[model samples]
Target: MAMAIRYERPYSHSAHWARRLAWVGLVVFLAAALSHRFGPLTTPHFLVLAGSGAALSALAVVLSGIGFIRLWRVGARGGRAAFVALLLAALPLGVAGYAAYAYFTRPMIYDVTTDPFASPPWLKVPVAHQDFLARPPVTLQDREIQATAYPELTGRRYEGALDRVLEGVRKVADEQGIVFTGEAGLENVISDLEDLAVKPDGDTGGESAITVVPVPSARPLEEGFLPRIGGPSDVLLQGEWRSLVFGFRFDVSIRLREEEETALVDMRVASRYGPHDLGLGAAFAERYLKALDAQLLGIAGN
Candidate 1:
């Protein structure tokens, strides 16, 4: 007798929910991107939404993968739809993955400072971040990074009076929309280094105010003054970056020393945060210095 084979009908599946979930992921990702790119969505809000959307899309991809496998193994209906679901789900998942990687791997610094060791210390306030209390004043890594990245930002000597230099510094800062919070007069501007040093926490004896002081140089300038005094101005800058109203506070010190026929101007800008500044600090310094040049040279507006 010949053996007979029986053919069974394949299991039917519309896979409607799986396909819809994939489209939902894509839609959510696009919404998040649009909100972040041009939005009422704040940075924090966008971050939360983007992160959540990515995770949901990843889940959808997994589900779609399972659906695809089922359709293939049992010869079920909607195989094409299952494959489409998988492809669509992947788009958001990949974007979210990249973003997470960048956030964690990239440096934690967004602010920059020029003279970290000599920059004014922040007061013991709730708004102060961890950067204000950095140990060793300036870190070796920060020095190396700045030296390599911005070698041209060193202090320069200009011929002018101390008062003029101070005024120029203020004017340039104002033009750049940087707000000064505190002012140290000429006397305090040339104070001793030890007195102006940022002390350890809980000292309570040190002045909380930002001080202007002379950059202590080993060799005295015979043609000019021994040490040039710099006025320290605490500035808070507010701007928008990536759907967020970003604010960063730093110090700009303008040093002026009088000579027979000229004065030297040394300007330095340093921020409390480090590792990276997104070039904001460097750009600010460059712009202010250029404007000060125009002002000191009396060529501004001409």
Candidate 2:
């Protein structure tokens, strides 16, 4: 009698390593995202973790490809492991790919303003030390790029009083969940309103004495410059917004200028971190403006 022949199928070692790498990558990516969202990890730290996760995922994908080729050529087990590894790696790889695409295609600007020439001043300026990336200040070239890329992001003019427009702005901001961090120039509006209310009629001009009270001012005073007794020329409202998913903070400033009977509104938005906002600043500005337009419907002008 002839002896019976026996064979044992070999498993792809590449497939097993691919699966292990995919799981590790996925875990790292999740930890990074969640820590950034809810913990104390800074932007730089988060970026490092994310990059590491992406690199591991990419390696896993390469190993999975190799495993598939081997399985196709030579009969081998662990094909299921390779397939699962590929699936597991897809999430981080897809996100990294999308981010890369956006970085190349979109304007590499973290700040955007409706009026680039006279951008709204920040009431609470960003602290330089807090930024780990140390992005350079916005330049003239950046403004030009923004203008060309986002032509529709112009300031809004309304045929309404500054106070009325400001009320609408507050309402819209509240509706959109923007938290007011600081403000300036509102006292001037109040002073102007008081002056209008207490104006003397014609031929009733007389010397009037008014007592001034000193109070702590939020507005910064320039060296050798006297503090204004009257209100500022323009009202500035500074606020912050956070993304719902990632909780990424964004600084926002809205300037309201009273031009006779009209109110001109300009807005600026900037990401709290990163050199590239991926056009999110422009998108938020546009969304806020549209919401404001809807709130102030008939009074909106060019």
Candidate 3:
């Protein structure tokens, strides 16, 4: 009598674990990214979730590598699962790796300005309390690094009136999806100098004496009798910009000054929260300047 044949197929547990970890990691990464983008979670929380996901993904990669070794040596039945795990882990791992590369290669600065000597002041002040990272002030060394790394990020000088240049600036900003938050020096204040006149003094009797007096008008003049010479005429615009994919916040300040027949434009961009901007501030400033140049193509000057 012949005994009944028996057969058993063994599968690699490492491959199965790798697939499960990859799936879990991918889900966590997506949740973290979506929550951060939609404002449901703070940046610090998001970072924690993202880091956890990346760590899991890295572990999955290692497990998958081990699974492949086991399959070559012991002929495991779960090779397909290992391959799928590797593919699934690639997304989060690739993103984390690229971010690491940027952090290492790029300048470690978050703020950039066209005029480093006198950067444009922010019309919309940042909130005193931030949720996560507290951005540090841009130092002289940071400015030097920015200048060396991005020499082309310079101010623009256009041969146009303040009003015209302002219009172009607004248009470019709108096209670039910058949301205006605050503004200054955009309105014209009518001079009160014309409200004063030389009136004949009644106390002078028959003498031809005259005295300068304030003429009563509907609008009250500002305090002090002397007329102000060359008041603040520079225009400043502050806005908030966000990245298309990640929605990272950035604060932007644009200053326009009228000098003779030309208007000078300067911009300052700073990350809302982070020590390093990954070279995005300079890129944003350059893009804005180029768009403004295109807007006033014929009026751009050296």
- The top-ranked prediction according to TM-score is 2
Worst lDDT 10-window in candidate 2:
211-220
Say what the RMSD of model 3 is: 13.3
TM-score of each: 0.44, 0.81, 0.80
Backbone collisions counted per model: 11, 1, 0
RMSD, model 1, all Cα superposed?
14.4
Better of 1 and 2 by TM-score: 2
State model 3's lDDT: 0.77
- Model 3, 1-302: lDDT tens per residue? 99999875678999989999999999999899898888767656777898899999999999998899889988887799999999999989998898899889889998899877667887656753455666677788888898898988888776555666777789999999899888888773222221222336464455533332211112122355433222387788899898776677789998877654456788999887778888877888899888888877643221
Off by over 4 Å in 3: 1-7, 128-135, 188-231, 298-302
Sort the candidates on TM-score, descending order.
2, 3, 1
lDDT of 1 at 13: 48
Q: Would you list the C-alpha lDDT of every candidate in the order shown?
A: 0.52, 0.78, 0.77
- RMSD in angstroms, all models? 14.4, 9.5, 13.3
The Cα error of candidate 2 at residue 102, in Å, is 1.0
Model 3: worst 10 consecutive residues (lDDT sum): 212-221
lDDT for position 8 in model 1: 70
lDDT order of candidates, top first? 2, 3, 1
